[model samples]
Target: MVIVLKNQLRIVKKNIRQFIENITSLFSSKISDLLLAILLIPYLISKVGIENYGRYVFALSLTLFLVNIINYGFDLSAVRELAKNRHKPKMLKKLLNKVLSVKLYLTILMLVILFVVVFTIPLLRVEKTMYFFALFLIIGDLFSLRWFFMGIEKMKYIPIINVGSKLLYVFLVIIFIKQSEDYEIIILLEGIGLFIVNIFSFLYIVRKKRIRIKLISFYKVKCPVLK
Candidate 1:
């Protein structure tokens, strides 16, 4: 019937509009990240000197190496599973609980490995403090609801959350970092920025999406491991 066709057309148009909005927001956020990085990197490099900058990079790189290991490729799986079941609120909550539980276990295991590597490696041992500071990055990343929002195909809030946190980070860095000794604050800022953005995003989801994150047992279903 014509009414059925009209309804379908309206739905299609609405979805298209939403898709465009999501893309625009995501793009803008990415641009902001790039611009912020471009502005900060030169100032940081010159302020800290080459040797200190290298050390900081080395520490962050080592930390991110663990990140790759900790993630263990759950990103795609989470997006697929969550996105497929986005319409069902109960299912979304259940999936989120399971994902968080599994990720927590994974984090514990990865952290054990991380500390082992940090203690054994000479480079990491020297930068032990920074290495430890960078570990919070993993926690920040894990708690980030980026996958959840991406699954639901809602991206408007991400830009706001990301930019706000980054702005604060920039402010802190500018105010506090003056010389090489202050380079430790850089990694901490990265971790803090991630933590803050995720906190904002998580709270937004809880309030606006009406999703509760409770500790649920994964015993009933076969839980998927990151490995």
Candidate 2:
């Protein structure tokens, strides 16, 4: 009986330690992101010139707005749902599929809207290429299943994967952007980095957690299953 009690205590301590580590990882990731942004922004503005940098920022802002719409508060709501139903593997898997499918549909709709908005406006139409590159950001965000890690309460991978991806973007900009003409590469690099890292994260989750992701049909996704 005493041995059983000792084992339980050890398990509790391990869980607490892991929880603290995950929290620290999250904090560090945020700090790294800020630092990277600070380091990259001035360099980009100097290399690409203010006007081009402004264009990239403008395109990014529009893409970000659409990205958030597609996200649809799933980061909060889906995480809560997953946490509540985590013990039931079958239900959790179904919920994950539904959430992803719904987001996919939203993303397609937003893409169509973005295309129309970008082309109809003269200012946006003039810089359509830059806007085209910015579309990568939305694609990256769509594949980034950060909520899954948060829901499962195994957040150690989040910092590593995200920071690495952002660092890659910074590296690419520094290496490739030598003049004002290279400005378009900035957003393109960022999008590429984001997409690669999130893909890796998704694969890691599937392999390590043994979670299969079979997206549900649109009909099922549109059902009131996910609120």
Candidate 3:
């Protein structure tokens, strides 16, 4: 009975440790996101002038709508799937591949749609470059594997890479953005940071985590969408 109790206590301690780590990492990432908004957004508004800033925000809103269409609730569903299959290497790889493949297809379709809409709308046509630049945000999100890490309950890397990338973005903005004209590059700067960090994180997951991404057939990819 004493030995059994000791084993149970050990399990409890391990679970508690994991819970604390997850909470701490989540908190750190959220704080960094908040800081990015609080610290950089006002600076951007000031440097870019209200008119240009308003245009950027308007373009951003449009991009976000496409982002949602591409996302299609995979962020939540994939996390649940990953949690279930994390220990099963074959299943996990297949599932991950399906999700990635589907998301890639969706992104491409959205990009084309965005191109059409931006060109069709006379108002959006004026700052079409900004709209196209904002498309990179979708691409950046495409490569982000925060859902995978969260599924495995290893949240540490999310905050580290997130904070690093945001810091890089802030630094680049401060150095390059001198006047309202520079507002055009603001989204592009963010895209650069996201690409650098997310690509690194994706490679890290592949090499360090030993998870490989393979392309599957449309038939295999079709079921995930229905589910």
Worst 10 residues of 3 by lDDT: 217-226
Q: Which stretches of candidate 2 lie over 4 Å from their true place?
A: 1-18, 223-227
Residue 190 of candidate 3: its Cα lDDT?
83
Candidate 1 lDDT: 0.79
For candidate 1, list the clashing residue pairs, or say none: none
How far does residue 207 in candidate 1 sit from its true spot (Å)? Answer: 3.8
Write the residue-wise lDDT of candidate 1 on 1-227 in tens digits. Answer: 99999999999999999999999989999999999989988989988888888888887887777777656656688778888888888888887777777777667777888889889998778878877888778788777776677788877877887888789788878887898898876888888878887877777777886777776455632356422
Model 2 has an lDDT value of 0.84
Which residue pairs in candidate 2 have backbone atoms (N, alpha carbon, C) closer than 3 angstroms, thus clashing? none
Estimated TM-score for each candidate: 0.89, 0.89, 0.93
Root-mean-square deviation per candidate? 2.5, 2.3, 1.7
Candidate 3 Cα misplacement greater than 4 A, ranges: 225-227
Candidate with better lDDT, 1 vs 2: 2
Residue 127 CA displacement from its true place in model 2, Å: 0.7
